[model samples]
Target chain A: MIWLVWRQHRKQALFALAALAALAALVVPTGLTMRGAFADLGLPDCVRTLGKAGPANNETCLTAFQQFNDEYQGFLLVGILFLVLPLLVGLFWGAPLVAREVEHGTHRLVWTQGVSRRQWALAKFGLVGAATLVIAVGYGLGIGWWLGPLNSAGQRNRFDPLFFDMQGAVPVGYTLFAVALGILVGTVWPRVLPAMAGTLVGFLGLRVVLATLARPRYLPAETLTFPIQGTAVAPRETASDWVLASGVRNASGELVVRGGSIECPPNATGPGAAGCGTGLGVEPGAYNWQLYQPADRFWLFQGIETGIFVALAVLLVYLAVRRIRRIA
Target chain B: METALETDQLGKRYGNTWALRDCSLHLPAGRIAALVGPNGAGKSTLLHMAVGLLRPDAGTVRVFGETPYDNTAALAEIGFVAQDTPLYRDFTAGELVTMGGKLNRRWDGTLARTRLAQLGIPPDKPVGKLSGGQRAQVALALALAKRPRLLLLDEPVASLDPLARREFLQALMGSVAESGTTVLLSSHLLADLERVCDYLIVLHGARVRLVGPVEDLVAEHRQLVGPRHGDDPIPGVASVVRASHTDRQSTLLVRTDGPIGDTSWAAHEVTLEDVILGYLADGDRPTSNEAWGVPA
Candidate 1:
């Protein structure tokens, strides 16, 4: 059974290897260059001292950080490749696993062999699932290593959706989910092209819904209140925190308006703007509030999201196995 | 005789229509049975059930007295070449043979290779690149290598040209002779199975219409020509399978238990093809003798 699985999917496995090598070709050199620039600019020391330094030294650190961001920001496009890798695995490797067999009527041939259909399905899923896991973990670690300098320089937050999805254990979860979804869709649909299309739509749709509607709500966001001024107070070390919402709140805790800025009279200027707040029926206790998930929750969030996706993958695989058994 | 495959009151349905219904028959050991029917006569359905590819909705299908559905032991003993003889197009013939060897517990790699060599089939060429006849032969070789006790073929020669059909059957017969395997070969064309099969099962309207030894089926059915009489029963003619009438002449294909003794009728011997056609034509009528509890 193992030999048969390899014989059937060896081409797809080779294709995945080539794709991984191609991705490596793009990331390896760029990662080295970014790391070199990080060391050259002494950005590591600068980031460590950013909030604690005197005004003059702080200015220098900000300038160095700005330069690093300007130089390496374009490389963020490589993250898109990592983002799409799992989807490609779903379509090319997973969608056609069972679909092509049924479409070509080869399932009838293989199922009637000495091995039962259930065994055939399990062997394919086991081998393919293990391969996806290895590839996804390897890719995730590679992305983590490549993005280390940028993330350390405080140019991008690890909590950001793009970076979060591409790094840590979540990519492995995504890959497993995508592959399992592809298999389940193919088993139910029994046509390669349509199953691939369905997998694409389902995977992307669930991702969008989860990222937008469910991620921020994974845990109750912490809120901070500060005096209303020219702008909301910038926390000393919030570079890695995910700010979900920030707005002005009145004394009664009702949101007066939903923005970091407060409008003032045209005649009011400089210090006079402080008095403008009272003219608008704003109480003296009115303050700005920021809702955020702290940087300390990064690993917690990764575990949560990974748990969600992995659970979904397991469910999809179970359903696919059940469906394959009942198929005529 | 030991039974190789048997189905009791087996039935299957798709949507609102039954693809096969009340299908019950037995293929004894070492007999090549022809499952003959028209295109929609449920021949494929029955073969699929026997191989456990399809689960019967009503009754049971057993191979060597063991239920075949999801039973690895039963599956190991049944070889099936589905319609069109589907194979992995990307693999070469040799690779397919290797795959078969890897997948089956009892494999005869030497027989597969030797047969392909004798047929002059290039083992290294991808099966998709082979001619339709070569593909069918490769499929047959793969199935034969399993050394299965029962081989079920569904419309194996339906798409082959006459010469290719003959060659494919010849290869199958050669292997069968060597293995003494019980074979159930299905086809809409009677001529394909007439020469090779000693037993026959005729399916029509998703039901088994006739089943027996080929010679016995041919012997019991005869065409009787006599004076036209409106719905009149004839002595020694047990049941009318098919009938046609002109102004003063009535010709009826009838099944009987004994030789026709009435001198008013001239009984002519019928071929296997004639018997099959008679049963198939009988399918279109509102009523049949089999429906009336007459033994088929």
Candidate 2:
């Protein structure tokens, strides 16, 4: 089944491999050493800027060694890449698995062939599902090896939440989640381009809203909003912001914060809180909000969240299978 | 009569409009039946019911004396060819044949191979690249390779050219003759239908208008040309499918069990197309001729 699915999607596989290979070759230097200029251009300067660059470093060997040991934040890019395309495949490629047949009335031929609708749908889902798993793992392994040096160097650098949460097993988990989301969207909207746009728009919207609503400026625990002195946005969006970090919990526990700094509202009562009701308060710690460290709780929360999304995916798939089977 | 497929007053409604109403058909084994109608005549709906694709709001469809759904053993007795003949564009002909072979228990790989070869679909050619006519042939091959007891086809040749459609029907009839398989195919081309179909079902306005053996139907109905007497009906005429009159003469398409004894109207033998168009015209009228249980 997977072989069939892969055969159909060999074009995408080839494209992904080509992209990865080209990037790898562009970065390669003689003997694949840290002495290469590509190494300096990619991370050495960035590490020095972070005040963590080591001298005359065998960074390639370090990078190669750290590929497994150190968590590569760049693996998140792999997640983003896998996240976007498979979703497209699901919408454009997978959506037509049944709906197109029914739309064109070809499903009737397949339907009457003594193969139950359940079996038919199962074959498609099983095949595509396996393909997704393989793609996620392959991508995860490749990026983990390629960007090892940056991750090891960044361990000494200031807290960069993007790279911080991207290491180890988390990127793989997130990519799978995104792919599942894409599949679910495909099931819901079976027309090719519409499903693709819908998945992108819907997921992007949800991510944006979640990021905003869970931020300290929008809503804080006990306090309506944070009372930070000034907005502390980074020069680049890639710069680590403590407030919007993923795996971070919300004050109300209803949601999770992704990353960004939030500006606060006034205090509720007492001391400086007396001026809070009548005035636009400027005092720091007037409604003090604390940021939590990434801990066991964070991973537990991540696991729980990914599990819920996966469950939703499974339910959508079940409904889709039933729908396709009901087609005569 | 012992029937291979039977529908007991099957009815289906989509929202406010009824797509099929009280449609009853009994097709016996080893007969080539054709379901004929104009567009939106409930032909597709009725076929869907027979194949267990759609559930009737009222009544039932039984295949080989049982429902065709979920019952794998029951379905194994049937193969279907649907209209539009759509295939996965990315898959090659070889892959599709392989798929059919793997999925079906009674699959005849030799038949698929032979048919595919005869159809001239090379092994590596993508289904997407095949022309409309070639795709239809591949679809037919897929259906026949199952070695079904009963074959249900919905408008299998609606899009094919004259030669290709003729070839499809001929090949199908040839296979049926060899295997004694009961085939039910739907098509709009009367000439092709006349050549192959022994049994006929005419559907109009979501209802079965007329059904019987082709020979009997052709024998009973006649294209009569004569002067109209609005006050006096034709002698022994069961039903007038359509009536159009000029000042000097009237033409009445009449269907009767026996001959209508009207010397004034020259009883000309009706072609299959005339028979089909007649029923369609009858079903189109603000009908009061509800001798059968046709819904109001």
Candidate 3:
């Protein structure tokens, strides 16, 4: 049975591996260069003591850090690839798994063999599911390694939706979920192209809704009050705070909307234009209250998100098996 | 003794239409049964149900006296080559045989190899590149490699040319001769089933119209000719399967157990094709033998 599954899907499995290999080729070299640059500029120690640097050293370290960061805009492409990798898995690997068999009338061939339909489905899911997880894990490790310096420098947040999904264990969950979604749609549609289309649309819709609406509420946001120090609290001190929302509030918990200054030209692109509306007015004793998930909760949030998607993947696979049984 | 295949009031419906309904059969073991019916007569539906590829909406179907639906042990005793003989287009013939060997506990790899070798097919060639007849042969080889107790084929040669169809059937008969496997094959082409089958199950209008040994069924039905008779009943006839009247004479295809000894009628033995056509013609109008005014 294992041999059967491998024989049927070796092409797809190899294709996935080749994709990962290509990504490795790109990230490995770029990652080494970036590390070399970081070390050569002596930015490691500076980044390690970023917050406590003396004014004179701070200026020089900041310039070195900017140069290191500017050397690799290629990471943006890698980010986009990780974001779309799950959909590619769903379309090429998952959707075609069952849909092509049905479309080509080959399901009848395997179904009528000594193996039962349930066994056939189990073998397929077992092999392909494992392959998808391996690819996702490899990708996760590669991207995490590539982004390690930026993250340690406090330039990238672990909680932002894009970075969070691309690193840690969340990519594994997303890959599994996308594959499950593909299988479910393929079984229901029983046609290759339509199932692929449906999976792409369904997967994108699910990721968007989950990331924007459902993810932040996985754990309650912590509330904090601090004195409104000169203009807008300087955006949070920690890059990974994952601020859900923050604004001026009176002691009674009411919002105080500050009006923009009439003296600034609207939508200016000049250097100081961004801060033009701030310092317009200040309410006495009013503090800037924040609702946020702090950086320390990164693992907890990762666990929660992965748990939800893995659970959904399991359900989709179960449903796909049931549908396979009923296919006859 | 367990029969090769049996169905008890088997019924299947597609939406508002009934593809097969109230169908029942008891095919004895070791008989090469041929299911003959015109297009849309539920022949494929019956075969599909028997192999467990289709679930009956009502009643039950058993292969080797056990329900095959999700029953691996029962399913293991049966092998099916569905219509068009669908195989993986990209898999080489040898790879498909390898798959068969891996998937089936009872698979005969040597038998598969020998069969393909005898067919003069290159084992390394992809199935998609094979001719329609070669593809059919490969499909049959895969199914036969399982060494099933009962082999079910649905129009395996439906798409082949005359020579290919003959070759395909020749290989099938060769296997049957070698292994004594009970085979139940369905085809609408009466010419195809005439020489190969001993038992016959004729289906029409989603019902079994005639089922018995070919020799017995042929012996029981007679073509009767006599003077014009009104829509009147005829004695010594079990049922008038078909009837037509000319200005001066009447021709009737009738089923009966007794000998037709009346001087008013000329009796002639019926051919299997004639018997099948008679039943199929009666298929459009639903009526039974008892409803034909035969005295109880």
Q: What interface RMSD does every candidate have?
A: 1.0, 2.4, 1.2
Q: What is the TM-score of model 2 when looking only at chain B? A: 0.90
CA displacement after TM-score superposition, residue A234 of candidate 3 (Å): 4.0
In order, what fnat does every candidate score? 0.89, 0.60, 0.70
Best prediction by lDDT: 1
List residue ranges in candidate 1 displaced over 4 A: A51-57, A152-155, A229-233, A236-238, A261-283, B282-296
Write one digit per residue (lDDT tens) for candidate 2, span B1-296: 56888988889888999999988889988889999988888888887777777767889889889886566777788877777786766678888888777667888978988988987888788888998788887887888888988888888888888888878778888888999998888888888888898999998889898888888898888888887658476786888888888998888888876767767778889887788888877534566658766776
In Å, residue B205's CA in model 3 sits off its true spot by 2.6
Arrange candidates by lDDT, descending. 1, 3, 2
Encode model 2's per-residue lDDT on A1-328: one tens digit a residue.
4444466567865775676566456444321543343364455454434322322244553454344224334444553443343345445445555545555555665667767767766876776666666655555454445444544343321123333333344344444445445555555655555655666676556544533443233223221234333323212221222333322223344323334433423334446545332243223233323353322243444444445445655766776776654455
- Docking class for model 1 is medium
TM-score of each: 0.93, 0.74, 0.89
- On DockQ, the candidate that comes out on top is 1
Candidate 2 regions exceeding 4 Å error are A1-96, A99-106, A138-188, A214-296, B119-121, B224-227, B231-235, B259-266, B282-296
Pairs of residues at least 3 apart in sequence or in different chains that clash in candidate 3: none
